[model samples]
Target: MHEGTALPGWTEMLVLAPLEWMELVGERLCVATCATVAYGAPSLGTPRPPAGMDYVRAYVLDSADTRELRALVEARIAGLADATGARELAGLTVRFRRLPPEDYASSWEKVWKPFRAGPFAVLRPSDRRALRATDVELRLEPGAVFGTGRHATTRLCLALLATRVARGERVLDAGTGTGLLAVAACKLGAGRALGFDIDPAAAPHALHLATQNGCADRTEWRTGGFEVLDAADAEFDGVLANIYSDILQAHAHELCERLRVGGWFVFSGVPDDHALATRAAFDAAGLRVETERTRGRWHAFAGRKPA
Candidate 1:
């Protein structure tokens, strides 16, 4: 479930979930999703040295009904032991990709132009302005990470954030890749906003956007993994995590813990096929789905902790 070095056979997990799971596992855990029968290493990153005969882990769930689910999952694996369709094999196994850390660099930019949304103004560094239902002000910019206002996921998140970010509401952007969501929350009337990202490039880019959006004081940025999220102590009126699927499921617990009662959590960056699984995980975490928005194959779900 965790590792002390860069994981091996991580890319194969991409078969089971979207690319985001690797991000969610943070600096721990190797990847081997249901999509793959055998494990592999991440294609990127400088893989760390092997753990020396410390074999990776494999787990099998014993729920009565889950046997079917496991069978359904294992059937999708690329290779397998004579499965004989054994549902008992329904579980995950990650093989350490005996390597060093690889690098993941996001190529994004800011767009500074006159954009209008309702009576408000925005900078449309992303194509998100095109999806606007009402005229709002915005500026565009290049970013380190992709998917700001221009991406469907980000746009959907903005639409939902607009409705809930009342004046003085505290906001958090869990995977603040570009800090766009946090800035949007601030512009939408949130009292304050903070962002965190696993990638080091995230903070500076996000801070720059915050300053450009005139929310320098309203938005704060941090560097660290989800574990660094402990700084939040169940604070935040709204949270946004526009990450891929596997990581989303892995962090479902931390996300629930970080949200305040009656607060909202917006999740995006999921592929269409994984929406139900993602929703199921959120429900299992005790968060209530208040709104659902989808564009193309991506879905943005808004949920809340019980008030």
Candidate 2:
């Protein structure tokens, strides 16, 4: 999908809310709309949102029914504010406007230019000019998290996998946002891979990406969280997760159980301050922390399940 092509009746809804509300409100908006959402700190030359507001942009199909959909979403967010004792949030508004398809795609293509993530060169299909013969190229779909490999946490996970993943081994990718890690594992010569996420919307898109990357035959995607795993399903030689620190600690044991004895597990999406506690949780889960990778405030841990 090259940028600047005419795409009629497309809309982008931009929401600028407090930075602290980005996660809370962003997750709600994502779950409710199932649309592509992007977040970032406001910068100069950008429309100044209220002080310290993080910007979120959601893309949706423009149609006759869109007005009603937008209203219902506004009401839902307003109701959330009331329920959370944050009635001040009732003042928050969702701005909806027609977006030029080319502009949208072009904007993303600029920020999401091809970048090396460990041994893989993560690129959009439009970036064929930069392809290198020796690099493992991952052609990703634009407009979503996880798929682009833009996050520091995701980069660290990829770096760890470059060292640990082995050819012909089976792997599990929990909280598989774009299923990038699973597809990358297959690209890295893993025999088979399973990717699942708590969000039902992720599986279909992830599978689509697997097909685009020519790894569909080797990858299976599903919707579920830790409960999706079974004791009998402990055949995986490796596991990967890039999830929040709290959730990582809570599910450390179950995540480890999915790996075979002596199998590898790489986890990230943790802030640096939480690294010690997260490592301790995994250590108590019968895994030994072999290495830790940090990028900015984010941290990733690579561990080996006990034999």
lDDT tens digits, residues 1-307, model 2? 5456555455666677776566556545553445566786323577666776778766666663265778876776666677667655667777777754455544565666677988899887767675667788888876544556777788898889988888999999988988888888888899899998987767987888899899899988878988887766666899998988999999988887778899998899887557889999998989888898788667899979887
lDDT values for all models: 0.61, 0.78
Q: Candidate 1's residue-wise lDDT over 1-307, tens digit each?
A: 2346543321212222223232222212322332112122333352542432112222221222143543443454323223324333234343222222332122112122343332434555444535445554445465435434555677777777777777889888888887878888887778888899887878998888888778879888999877775663457788789987788898887788778888888889887768999998898888898888887667889978995
Off by over 4 Å in 2: 1-111
TM-score: model 2 vs. ground truth: 0.70
Per-residue lDDT for 176 in model 1?
86
RMSD of each: 12.5, 5.9
Candidate 2 displacement at residue 235 in angstroms: 2.7
> What TM-score, computed on C-alpha atoms, does each candidate reach?
0.59, 0.70
Best-matching candidate per lDDT = 2
Minimal lDDT window, size 10, model 2: 26-35
TM-score of 1: 0.59
Number of clashes recorded per candidate: 53, 1
Q: Which candidate number has the best TM-score?
A: 2
